[model samples]
Target: MLPETVLRTDDVAPDIRFDVWREAMAATMSPMHISSPHSSDFWGHTRLLTLDDVLLWPVAMQASRYRRTAELVRKGDPELYHITLVLPGSGRLKVDHSGRRHLSTVNDLYILNSSQPCDVEVEENELAVAIGVEIPRNNFPPTAERAIGRMLGHRISGQDGFGAVLSPFLSHLVSRNSAHRPSDIPRLKRILLDLVTGLAARELDAEPSLCTETRRRNTFLLMRSYIQRNYHDPGLTPRTVAAAHFISPRQLHRLFEAEGITAAAYIRGRRLAEARRRLADPAQYTTSVQTIAQRCGYTSAAHFSRSFSAAYGMAPREYRELEHRQQLDTELRSLAPPATAGRDPIPA
Candidate 1:
């Protein structure tokens, strides 16, 4: 599950709100000097989700100015880099290493190194909102340093190129309020890492340096994502997927082999999983089994029933009954009084 933290200026006393916010920012992120013209009436909020070694922060704040100085670099942790995506404001940023200044508008992204000195000023009239991803320096390829150095203080459009793919991903991750399953964290982390690596490699013209295995894994993930989005289309097949990705069917099968599953089997499994979920949902009870089957890409009810039974060891109707019974049992348990030690058990 993604661990989260939330901070707001309203939680502190009005007189010391800015100071509290500044201290919280330094502690949560890297040490930096933060100020605002309306410090006394400042309003800001930050929501952060931690996924393994990466930190996703979505922030909304009033006009503010911030700077990371050489002194702070010497005093703070200097092994992190921040990737920021502007959402609703315009700002000017300067990187000390390159001495270049850039104006960032909505959907523009830029990278900042914690070890380097930088200054950012957001206009007071427009609220500044952005999603910032904090990644460890070691998570990136060695060649990325040169690329990042060259790109620092420059605007990268999130509406085009690799940013088009990466921007929505980061945005979606931070937008979720529900906790993710613990088992899914590793896969999510790998996807994020690969996307960032690919972006950096593209910037450096160093795609060849990315290991072959990593590239294959990323391609497989891309295929899986495509399948998930388009699985309802009856035309989705291994051949179609391979063609979309510009790979041969044989090569696609080879990639799936590394995970000990065939491409066809994976697609079937995903469709079955979705069907099972719908069957177990109380709200979907009015929907017919045949309708559910077709909705999940099964051609006919008999085939769906056979596959469902083979995968779950129970027919769809039986599984739905079991799920309903389980839900009732949970509600009953919640309503019952707590058990007491040395006391007789409640009669059924």
Candidate 2:
């Protein structure tokens, strides 16, 4: 069964909303310390939405502190993980999760797993957006410890570089008018996981894990598979292919070099070969040359004809006609009566 929950707190008062959120969270998971600026009455709005087990929340906060201890916590243990993001104002964050500590500022993100106790304190009024992703610790692919814990708190600001592109993309997705379809959940999760893992590895200087020969080869194979699966799209190009693989143009070129071909030439040749096979099939007599070309990635029928003539010494239509005639000739010969030179079959 799929699980989805959405919470919007934009209009509700901060304290009242937090209280309701605390009770809901506590019931769903464990107990935790939830507070705001003691100096002033905090005023803000918040929204939380969960789609098929994934959660998204955007909150405008005046300032707050949230914590979960072991004593009164659910199941006699602390929460498993707390993932938070700061959208506005400046504050500090600290987590004591694994006998080690992680600390950051407002522009930063903090991911803390709650096998142990910890505290997060924000000092001033600010708006924040976050998603608390709770998954069993063992589910994550084991890598260097540096890549562990909540990840979005690192360098993804959704403002610059990869983060810049991703941040606004997510912000717009969570905006009031947007509606995410359930069918898109798989793709959404895949993209989100890729972005998170890539950013974490980059920030922690853990690229060696992803840059290993085996890993690179796996990526190469995956891209090759994707191309093979989508070779029929006429607009396929090096740039689009590279973007799909999350690599730069230069890197994509190098990948093709390692595989022994130029990207564009490879895709073009593969598509042409598919067209040629279709042309050779006697069963394709009713299929038009333009239909074959379109199915095999040629945008212009005339261009496909020219290219086919250059490559195979005949236009696609002519090739199919020739193939069909040859097949009929062969069938006629097979159906003809045995000549004197032919031996008669012996009775079994």
Candidate 3:
């Protein structure tokens, strides 16, 4: 997974929480003029996930206002692009130089350019939550790059089109950060980049710049998605998939060649991975190996056992037993009390 940084105003004294939050924002993001209610206390929290060159920040806090003046832009600017997905608040953003303004509300999204002077005002009386994605201005393809200028200060609806897919994907990513492995970051980053680019292209109606290679890659992605959803179906095969996509079996093979694996092999690998996960799950302990094998597309228990051993260097039964033992050890450790010096020992 991506590396994460979490900041909370609760970590500091209530009186100085706003000051600490302002400093942290200036260091992590760009400098801005901030204003909040005249109350004696402040509360805010932010979680930032860094993936390669992209940054995702999810924030929640008391309603406040912020402004990035031309002076601040001139002093120091990263020249980044930001897409803000507003969750539960009302706000309006104005591009000072362009005289463009966008009124934002719950489930709305807006794009901003770091090189421009902007002012934002959030309604008070309730907490406001938003997730912002930052990327280098040049990260988009030429088609999307041309559209960015016109998109500034314009509200994009998160309820439909590309926004519909992007909104939930980002929310889920932030909510499930702890469940991801390090190796999954690169793949997730690529998917996010593609989705962002596609959204821009859709907005600009730039189908030509999407090009043949990009379309091919998208087709491959769709094929993989189909496999994932249909892996349990015994009728799935290379010919069937190619026919569904209106392509020849030979073309299907060529598509997978780019991934360094054959279609059949990829399918088998995904099935095996799912089977292993099910086998290791504690809730599936009473489930028979033969049933799991059938559920994973293996018609014969012996065949599944042989293939599982070849791939994982152990039989399914042995793997399940080992996972069970590990789970029990973890439970025992959690139940045991901590040892302390000069403290009476608890009776077992």
lDDT agreement with native, every candidate? 0.80, 0.60, 0.80
Across 76-173, the per-residue lDDT of candidate 2 in tens digits comes to: 75334445555545455554544455655554554566565656655454434453444334434667234755353333443333344334445555
228-299 per-residue lDDT for model 3 (tens digits):
767888788988889977899999999999989999988889889999999999999999999999999888
Clashing pairs in 3: 1-181, 1-182
TM-score of each: 0.72, 0.50, 0.66
lDDT of 2: 0.60
Candidate 3 local accuracy as lDDT? 0.80
Predicted model with the maximum TM-score? 1
By lDDT, who's the top model here? 1
Q: Worst ten-residue run, lDDT, model 1? A: 89-98
Give the range of the ten consecutive residues with the poorest summed lDDT in model 3: 89-98
Measured over all alpha carbons after superposition, the RMSD of each candidate to the real structure, in angstroms, is 5.7, 17.4, 5.9
TM-score-sorted candidate list, best first: 1, 3, 2
